[model samples]
Target chain A: MTDDDLDLDLDLGPETPPVTPRARPTTREAPKSGVPSAKVMAERKPGVLSRVGSSVSGQLSHISRPNWSFRNFLIVLAVLVSLVVLAENWAAVRISFLGLRLELPKALAFLLNIILGGALTWFWLRRGVAAREE
Target chain B: MADPGGAWHRLLSLLQAISQRGLWATVPFALLVNSSITVLTLTIEPDGSAHRQISVVAAPYFRDQVPGWTRDVRADADWDMAWAVNREDDFVYNRDARIAALPESGEAAALTISDVAQNPFSLYTTYRWHEVVGYSYLYDSDPAAAEATNKSLIYEITMPGTVTNATVTPATGSSTKTEGPKVVFELAASQGQQTIEVEASRLRWGYLLVLAYLAAYVIYCSACTLRHWLRIQPRKI
Candidate 1:
């Protein structure tokens, strides 16, 4: 009642608990490969090709990592092939066989092959993933 | 149910792990099968009513070169005649008829048979021995069918042959005329060859196409199985 003069002794007849120190927010150390920060390099100067090369190499290294999946490779292959086919702009390309021939548009052929590849990939994934999951 | 995301990742992993040989094999295999399919559909004349469905036995009989037959056309080397008959009377009953010898000069090929079928319109008839081979008597029995334009009928194997170069005359009576034997028209090696020899053989073009596809599919299946087999082996590298 009087600034805890009388109550302090009454409430705490025993030892008082020590106050706990507040923890600091921890910061993570930068990775060793940091030659120069991207912002600093951009501000300093960056050649067009060098920038492109670095970006591309970064992607390539990422893809080449051991944990990369086969399905991703197939999808990339399909995409690249489809793009090339579309860019060629051929109409009704013909393939000949023993006294026979069929013509199909380039885009149609690429799309069809992609669909087939995707379906096969999906089937393979189902079996392997399901077993591993189990 | 556990996670589709995990399943897809596993699949991508499998695809990337496929061997280089497996990848290489797919290229040629696809090329072969796809090309063969294209050729087969594009070449063969679609089956039509004008197609003379003579039994293989009857086909030889009608050709008049049947060995030891009384009416052996081969033996009558000098015989050159032309005759026409109606469908119900001649073609239905008398399977064999004498056709004139092909003219020796002025043209390289002869017209043999011309039959027309219009539904998706296919005409499957042969030109043999210097004549166009078709349903010989149909023209007489079915005059209205004759007017049908697409009716399959063998009109005549012309005496003088037709000459076809790079320039083709479409719908022209004389330009695309089917000549006697294919030997006379193109493959000179076939000239003077016996009908039996030709009958026993297959078209080289068609045969080659089929074999290509067969080989491709076989390799593809083999490669597919081999990949699985190789996976079981202990890593050597």
Candidate 2:
């Protein structure tokens, strides 16, 4: 049945309900704000595209920031550069300088560079971590 | 109140993150260890064949028989000799072991000294002998009082035939011999053992180094493969 028809047939009491309106303070909670409030949701799962997008954006944010991660990136880059330098200057590295000349192979030269680079990396990283902790 | 499951998930994610970064440290270390092992392996293995055919001619030396009527002098000695060949001029030898010293008297034959030293400055020297086996012999006999004077001989080899390139049909046709220097030999039977000392240079060691490196690399690769397999096992399971 329609509400109006029900009301007309059963108008038994004049006292019903009272409604109030007032100007709220800043701290006071409003019933309907611009942002939707949390509700008992049915838990609609995120789609594949949404998940992928979120991950990609997170990675981008991490990469863009100049932080520890960036320093790590530079460290890797330096290592790569050193590797190239070792490869290109393989002959130079193999040859040792004294009063006379001594020649070794590219393998030995490459090994020396790796040892030096690894030791340096370890020392620098350890110190960096210690400083951060302090 | 919170879900216990959520905390487990976070911890697992953190562990994964740590492992991924940890791999960065381990990978390079593994590579270096593998490479070094490979170089060490190079030191242990033998290199491929180092063979060269070199023509050698040594200066003639005296061979003598003390008492003989018939004496023959011959400078044609067989030279089936071999020594080490080196790309680099570095000398590698067992110092404690006594090796017959090279000719120290007069200036060594240009070919012998140049070849031994691998002196680049002597690149233009015409003579290059790899092996030398040469000798000469003489016989002298005097008849007593009235007996006929017989058998006083000294022979020197001369005019060895030219080693010419000739074409010959295998079965159907006879091979033609072109005219060249006649092989001349005046024979005197003489018995004497003469030893001429020639320098055998230091053995080559580069090949050894290369071989060792190869063996080491192979071992390193095996280790790397093992490490990779071990690291992936947990993931697979």
Candidate 3:
């Protein structure tokens, strides 16, 4: 009941730990500028338009990479030239063949040229895949 | 890293494989086959008979629509005929009122023609004409029915050489008669089939030319393909 007894009682619990203040949860500081918080950025989902834009950019980057060789370029060029020649003299070339008859509109013919050109270019460029396999 | 020279060598090797394996020749072979079929289809008998069809339609288009309609029809018809014939010169379209005089030459004549008009539905009616030469020539509007009605179709064709015998099969609901040098027939507006079998002596050299050209092309492609294959073969040790 005395002051000494009270101090002893308060101090006697050496083995038992004293109640300490709980540590505050660590958090990233908010950006000084008007930028959004990391939580908001993490929580926000990518929109459809943004996703499409990123996908297209990725494809374009893959396609535009400098992986083509001189011979591949030459082959692609030759094929493209042939396609142009075919498109230009389509009627005459068609008539030369007795049974091969095809009549395509100008727009459709141009579209065909683009598709064939893209395909040939892709094939030639991707010959590296064959090299890797070998 | 890839061997820059190796890529070229591989390309050559691939091409060699294509030639040796006859992979690249598939397209040319297919073309040759198609050309052969076409040649057979267009062959003209010694009696100058061919498998051909002539159709006439009453184009229902105003002056403004006539050009577009005629162009579209002509393009379509030309594409269709190109499959069976070698030339488009045989098909003609008359834009004037004047009837073309028969050629003095003794050559076989087959022409599918269309007439031009300011207004097909107007009070003044315009006439369209077509000519075909074969043992049997079918005259119907079903082929061109989508373009216009053939209710008032009239055919005036002058067969080459002396006509031995001409007969119209299923002779019903159609008025057909022979004139001095031509046969005229009026077709019913409704959908139907009518065939005219004419026996006559005519000459056809276009078929021979087409066959020769196709044969030459096939031979050329085959020879080139074979030579390339042989040249690329590795020499024996």
Candidate 4:
């Protein structure tokens, strides 16, 4: 049908729905503690110490929080203590492994075990994040 | 499930405490247990009153005694009845043999045993004295300190006379060595038996015989010295 042939039924037929205004979220005030804006902050990589501290903290919070599972908490703690023990035994000695004997410092062993602790820490973090999601 | 006071539960609790408190949590226990190692040394006197010297490893048993000195040392002190009576001398610290330096430290202290009942405790009798020289403080005469300890104890007892016989109750892994008047009974930690019993007797005449022999040897040496001096002297002088 042509535009001129169509009847003008703006008021005669059913009422036309009004268009909803576009809503804009208001800007939040700057935090008093001087926290950087999430969008503005650079996505720089965390140092080794920072990553280790975060993992340890996450594992401990899992231990101390009221709803923490005992087995996981204990496993995490065991990982932490083993790491510390490895660090403390930073001395050179003859280490026999699978019939092959070699001399190495315990600190080297500690460096090798650090990754193991980090892995456990990551597991705890993933589990915690999953629980939170649930 | 393990009991709350059971070893497993206790270990879990300790781990929990360490997790809560960090590394500093262990420092107090180490300082209290490892630093003040208690060694009981008992030497029988001529009059038969056992002379006791309780020596303790220095405050820095694990660490350096001085700034640069790393030798493990136990400091000895004269016995004071007042100190023990006040309960200031009942510390239960003992050397952990696992610490490699302990065996080489050469810190052997003599602890006195007053538990032998004086009534039947005569040197003339050939009977055995089953002294409970472990942590049982029954013979310590301090009725208030009646707790049993689990630490390994080394008993270095000197008999006033010759040892007729010597034995340790837990003879397995336990060493009992007698050198004349002195008897050394070492109870290792792995033995797990807290009670270490020793059998000792005195030879009243042996002391006199030793003293007489020493005197005769001294006299003979003096006579030889005099003869040599006379022979070396100038005749005109």
Cα TM-score per model: 0.17, 0.17, 0.22, 0.27
Candidate 3, residue B183: CA error in Å? 1.4
lDDT of 2 by residue, B1-237 (tens): 766774565345334433442111011111111111101000000111111122111111101110010011111111122232222432111001111122223321112333223543332212211212111211122112101321111211111123132222121212223334211111111211111121222222333333454566568668878999998786643
> Ignoring the other chain, what TM-score does chain B have in each prediction?
0.20, 0.21, 0.30, 0.38
lDDT per residue, candidate 4, B1-237, as tens digits? 635554444355345433432111011121213433444565544332333444445343333322111112222222222121112433322321111111111113122323224433333423233343322111222222211233344557666546667776557556788887777776543342233334444443433443455566568668878999999998984
Least lDDT summed over 10 consecutive residues: which range in candidate 3 chain B? B22-31
The clash count of every prediction, one per candidate, is 25, 14, 0, 8
lDDT of 4 by residue, A7-103 (tens): 6553367776888995334255457799744543324667899989999999888774443344654565566556545543444444557866565
Q: iRMS of every model, one decimal?
A: 14.8, 13.8, 14.9, 28.0
Q: Which 10-residue window in model 4 chain A sums to the lowest lDDT?
A: A87-96
RMSD of every prediction: 29.5, 33.6, 29.5, 35.2
- Whole-model lDDT for model 1 versus the true structure? 0.32
Q: Which lDDT values do the candidates have, in the order given?
A: 0.32, 0.30, 0.38, 0.44
lDDT of 3 by residue, A7-26 (tens): 89878866866889963343
* lDDT for position B52 in model 3: 23
User: How close to the true structure is residue A104 of candidate 1, measured as C-alpha lDDT?
Assistant: 68
DockQ of each: 0.01, 0.01, 0.01, 0.00
